[model samples]
Target: MKVTFPHMGNMSIVIKALLKELNIEFIPPPPITKRTLSLGVQHAPESACLPLKINIGNFLEAAEKGADTVLMAGGIGPCRFGYYNQVQREILNDLGVNLNMIVLEPPDNHIGELLKRLRTLTGSNSWWRVVKAIRFAFAKCEALDDLERAASRIRCRELQRGDVDRVYAQGCQAIDQATTPKEIVQCRDEYLTKMRSLPLDHLKRPIRIGIVGEIYTLLEPSSNGFMEKNLGRLGAEVSRSIYLSEWVNEHLLKGLLPVKGHKLTRKRAQPYLNCMVGGHGQESIGATIEYAQQGYDGVIQVGPLTCMPEIVAQSIMPNVEKDFHIPVLTIYVDEQTGEAGLMTRLEAFVDMLERRKRIQVESGLQG
Candidate 1:
């Protein structure tokens, strides 16, 4: 089976590792670009969210490169994501692209079914082999997340602009090339060392900003207009609430290995949003509260326009700001969102945070 999956940030790296270990022939979709967005927009429904359109675009591109089987994750919440695979299948069929589609539902609810699907695709009924492949994939995902978190910090303090980014790109290439667990660990360590070696302004107190929003848009740079990199360029250290490894742990592993701060996230989110309102709405509220409590200077919420869950979260953010006394910025992006406009707003937000910090310090001195 020649399989393909949509790109969600560095998730492709994890997926590639899994497919390779399973001995599955696969076609990796090209990175999302203007051409991909254009193709997706041309065919998708006018009101579909940005992620769905981009996914359709990715599938179309993969189909062109002879991918006959598609693998997509499924959700079981109030989010519309559970239906994406079905919708995309119909869309591709209408476009005269015949392909096999498999949706891997949350393991909590469909582990047996998921495994059956995997066995079908890989033609391997060996449960042990499948388990080994999954463990390897999860390990790589953790390594990628660690590297990304380190890069975010290094980006803010790097004395030489673009040095961290250059090394990061090279590190990603190294991780992608490495095929075994030991190789992945070595690649991660080598990249971490290089990132640490970069000259940094140790005395500089950079503003820290927490990013929270829909999982897809928040994680995928192309979908969200590369907001994290833009924040770092504007002198803010960015921390995101969602990561592929975290999602796998929470949903697929069913919390067998508890994520640090998972309990605190639910606790902080209790006052404003006590329940999951679908998607990552509850997590966004919880993360913003945690960031505020941790003394972050600001928080930014990003999602596609008209996304129901983020819209729900956005409505509650003003109260969070009032209670926490931390600034919050909400950005809704669609296909037409301009990078220039995004950069301008980010600059304004960072400036506001900087000024607030100065005022607080001055008041402290006066007291």
Candidate 2:
């Protein structure tokens, strides 16, 4: 069986590596480009979330290439995502696409069943092979996460203005060119080292705000124009919530795979998340509260216009901001969103943070 899954930033790299370890044949759908977006726009309903549309397009393209089966992860909750598997199944059936979509359902509390579902995908029962795949997948996840985090720092303060983007592009190319486990690790470190050499703006006790919102606009630099990078460039330390590896190990293997990241495992953030919240945006609300209590300077929530969960969060956010004394900024994105408008809000937000910090310093001095 040839299995496939949708892209969630760099998670595909880890997923592809895991499939290779399991001796499963698979395809990596092309990167999200205009052509991919056009295909989705043509077939998907107008109201469907952006990721849902892109995923449908990805499945259709793969099926046309003679893929017999689709491998997907499933969700559970009031979030629209919980039903995505069922809906996609029906949609593919009506389209007369003869294929089997094997979904690894959410494991709120059941790893055995989840393992069984994964076994169906791999067509193997060997414990050793399972062990190898899990180890390799986790290793790859960590490597991808390291690269992403380093890239964020590099983008924030590229000392050599002109070389900043070039170095970053080369780093991504190096990452994508990697083929083996050792190669992946080496490339991640090499690129990170190269980028760290560049100078960044003086951090200067900048306000650190964690960015949490819809995953697409959060992770995809193209979708959100490197919003974190922009924020850091504007002098705020940006802490992003979603990393490709984090999502895969955290969201994909809550029950099985043995808690990939040891550090984050102690917190058990999934319950408030309620199954990765898919595109629901409820996770942002929880993250806001959590980050505030941890003393974050502020929280920025990015969502596309008309996003339901974010709109819901917006209604309750005033209470969060007032009670916690953490500033909140909600930046909405769409096709029409432009750089100028985003900069205006970002500059204003930074100004507000600076002014408040000044007042605090003055108040402290008075006391």
Best by lDDT: 1
lDDT of 2 at 32: 70
Encode model 1's per-residue lDDT on 1-367: one tens digit a residue.
Answer: 7999999999998999888988898999999999899999999998989999999999999999999999898878888887988888899999999888987777656567567767777684478888888889888888888889988876889888898888888888889888889999999999999999889887889999999998899889999888888889889999998888888777766665555535578678889988878888888899999899999999999989888989999999999999999888999999999989999999999999999999998999999
List ranges where model 2 is wrong by over 4 Å. Answer: 63-68, 97-99, 162-184, 201-205, 255-282, 293-295, 304-306, 334-340, 354-367
Q: Relative to the unseen true structure, what is the C-alpha lDDT of residue 213 in candidate 1, on a scale of 0 to 100?
A: 92
Best by TM-score: 1
| Model 1 root-mean-square deviation | 1.4
Q: In order, what lDDT does every prediction score?
A: 0.88, 0.71
TM-score of each: 0.97, 0.81
What TM-score quantifies how close candidate 1 is to the native fold?
0.97
Q: Could you tell me how far off, in angstroms, the CA of residue 236 lies in candidate 2 after the best superposition?
A: 3.2
Clashing residue pairs in all predictions, respectively, total 0, 2
Residue pairs in candidate 1 whose N, alpha carbon or C atoms collide under 3 angstroms? none
Worst lDDT 10-window in candidate 1 = 254-263
Give the distance in Å from residue 176's predicted Cα in candidate 2 to where it truly belongs.
4.8
Deviation of model 1 at 361, angstroms: 1.6
